[model samples]
Target: MLQAKMKNGQLITLIHLSKKEVEEIKSRGEEFYCPECSQPVLVKSGIKVISHFAHFAEKNCSLAENGEGAYHESGKIQLYNWLKKQRYEVQLEAFIPSIVQRPDILLTLYDKKIAIEYQCAQVPIEIIQNRNRGYLNAGIIPIWILGANKFIRISQNRFKLTPFLTQFLHQFSSSYPLLLLYFCPITSQFVKIQNIILTGSGQAFGSLSVKKLYHSAFPSLFSVDNYHEALTYRYWKREKEAFRQNVRGKLYGEELAWHKWLYERGTHYEYLPSSIHLPVKDQYRMKLPPWNWQSRLLMDILHPLSKGHVFSIHKAKYSLKKYYSPSVHFPLIHSHGEPILQYLHLLERLGYLTSISDTHFRKQMIFPFYTNVEEAVKGDRRLLEVLESKI
Candidate 1:
């Protein structure tokens, strides 16, 4: 502990120590615990002026692993080497002022200064907003070079819009040109950078390559407006709306058959009171016939049916076919009922069919002889027809 002389002529231990003493402590193999948290400090030692220590295990610690410090150190070294190769003034990880936050790099070009950030992960929206505000206040242009993981790692080939991401993208869509750089792990350097348009939904539009660097790849940048436009154009080109419209049109044709089938079935049975009800074993077996040659042919023609409806049909058929046959698996026949009901529930959720209420069925089933079999047949036929067309 370092001792200090107080004005009151009292000797006290000074909490604030010099950098040299801190270094000496580290060099002497003495663990430097955080004075604030009392946790072991992990130090990245032996630096050409870039050195810091902090608690690594604490989740709330400012130095928690975000790849920022490592990226900053490696980025500065890389930028310094690049500038030296280009015969330019080399200043790595320089500090700037606007709201008092220092950027990763400050490049001096003739009479102007440029601020650059090497971001390897998705940064918090607040941080990005703050950086933008600071850059604007400082009157220095800010450039962000994002890693490949942001664009290339996403599996969706077509762009999609989420409310939050869309808002974020729209905010920066036309502000500044974005530079996308691909880092090479082998060389521990950025191999290529390209200017890419980012849509209002954060989709990559197109790339413009740069080839000026010593490596085969060079870093590139794009204006925000161009990025947004390009992304919108790409999204429109995918044309999912047209596909949905086509599906809707085909569905309209088969709706008549389904209406007929439902009307003919009426609501005489207890299960028919609610569309959500599971069919009783005997009722389910008697209602639908097994998959005969004709039915099988029709199902084959309607190759692509909704998964829910398909499950219902297959379950009904399996249950009936196995009812009287003792040799057939009982579990397999009973197992299909749950899946069928689940599928019906899904269709109801999607707004394709209405639930059968007690009142509606009671009115139709007033007379014992008054079975609406014709309507049910027509509705079933229509439904099957529509499913066929979809397939």
Candidate 2:
């Protein structure tokens, strides 16, 4: 906790308090109380840790349970002071009485109140959801900024997307690209992952941007960046090959069922069509990985259809509802449309299906199948070439 209330009902912060002021404050013997619980708090100063308030260990306050460490405490103050310099009305560790929630930094933009939570520690998804619900009920928008230590960068544009990290993904508007924000106190760097494509259950590729916190402004966080289609497909080629290795590694669970289903279809993993696991921009809506549901649709739905046979996405979605994650699951995204619709469009481009209507498509040609890995790799490259041209 960085803020405490004086006996005179005045709120004071140790964010910019000097050593002399700290000593003077301790000498005065004035009592300082917590703003959240209204309990008496002690001023703590150390050689390494930032000077701040700490509740008594015996106290049983909800805020005391948070235990915001030195990393979170310093980062919160840094962001608060950074935002304050831009002339934006920013409040540090602002406690909202109506919601019984305290955001690390609360910024007011006219009528809109945005609660910025700088979460350095890993917390349960339910805690995050409950807090967000409380803030939204009070008509306050909540933005969570992760500590850069959680940013799992596997390559230049590639990263691991764990279930915990997905909650931070934000899509401000329909026209804006989805992104997540990351800040590191030690490095003083801010990382923005924009235009992310969810390729697997836990893997994603995105346009990554890193800049010093001092070099950035508040509005810059929402700035849209161009999607690198060439770069995506270039790296996707490697991921496509990795997909083959991954399937062989999995021996049980839903993947085993998928393999058994494929076996019944008179085909095996290596011999399956190259079109199975291609990228869908809106794939986050799917509960399963891109390969699983995409393979299911390719085999069960399209493979049996004769030339000119029409299929509707609506019916496909209903029949395969279990594969889809409900729209409500993505509270931060404004609109992702449909992964199936995008997949259909991709098939249309690849000559597997022809458009009949917005909801319907006609099968034009049978999906290509390769006998071996060498042939499959070539087919994948051809499809990627088509994608690159379209991009």
**Considering every candidate listed, which one attains the maximal lDDT?**
2
Residue-wise C-alpha lDDT for candidate 2, range 127-210, written one tens digit per residue: 877887898889998898998878888889889887778877888887777799999999888999998888775879999999
Give a tens-digit lDDT track for model 1, residues 110-224. 7766676666556565566666667666776665554323434333333322222221221123233323444432245442322333222224333333333355322232322
- Measured against the true structure, the TM-scores of the candidates, in listed sequence, are 0.39, 0.93
The per-residue C-alpha lDDT of model 1 at residue 83 equals 54
Give the candidate number with the greatest TM-score. Answer: 2
Error of 2 at 349 (Å): 1.3
